[model samples]
Target: MDAKETLSGLPWWVKWIAIPVIALVVFGGLITAVIGFIVGLLFKVLVFAALVGGVIFLVRRFTSASSSSRGDW
Candidate 1:
């Protein structure tokens, strides 16, 4: 009949443990791929942000040094 009725007849381990284990066994590869992709994308984004920040820092440092040398500061 319904899921509750079907699961209720089963043991606790079957309902909680076995079903989840079986589902993971069936879809483990897909789940792992999705997680790996997300992690890789996040890592790439962090690297890009760091590079942009470094460029900005270098530009500001050089501009300040050059302006101070010319008696502007």
Candidate 2:
């Protein structure tokens, strides 16, 4: 049988609701996954930045103190 004949066997509501509902579910899943990946990447970037800043701070403190001690001699 043709597509129309096959679909016509089902109730009209099934045809209308089933197609749209399935489409929404598939599209929604894809949207959710993309959003999740973006948020996770942002989190990783922020953490890496914080670690780099902390290392710079410690190095600056140690070097300044060593320099001042030598200058006093």
Candidate 3:
């Protein structure tokens, strides 16, 4: 009645290859969806970070340039 006793009688391919293939066939969609969501979230975070950095750089560049032009430096 134990799993080890049941699996021991099966062929090696059944234990290794068949079982894993069957599991993926059952749960593959959920696994793919979860992975896709994580990748998309990471991409959005990277894009937001780039936009914020660009804004900071432009602000600093223009502010410094205008102040120097005004002979404040």
Q: What Cα-based lDDT does every candidate model obtain?
A: 0.97, 0.91, 0.98
Query: What is the alpha-carbon RMSD of candidate 1 to the true structure?
Result: 1.5
TM-score of each: 0.89, 0.60, 0.80
Q: Candidate 3: which stretches are off by over 4 Å? A: 1-6
Q: What is the lDDT of candidate 2?
A: 0.91
Q: lDDT tens string, model 2, 3-42?
A: 9999989998889998888887979888888999999999
Q: Per-residue alpha-carbon lDDT of model 1 for 1-73, expressed as tens digits? A: 9989999899999988999999999999999999999999999999999999999999999999999899856
> Across residues 1-73, which tens digit of lDDT does each residue of candidate 3 receive?
9999999999999999999999999999999999999999999999999999999999999999999899966
Off by over 4 Å in 2: 1-23
- Best-performing candidate as measured by lDDT: 3
Candidate number that wins on TM-score, 1 or 2:
1
Candidate 2 TM-score to native: 0.60
Candidate topping TM-score: 1
Which lDDT value does model 2 have at 41?
97
The predicted structure with the larger TM-score, 2 or 3, is 3
2 against 3, candidate with superior lDDT: 3
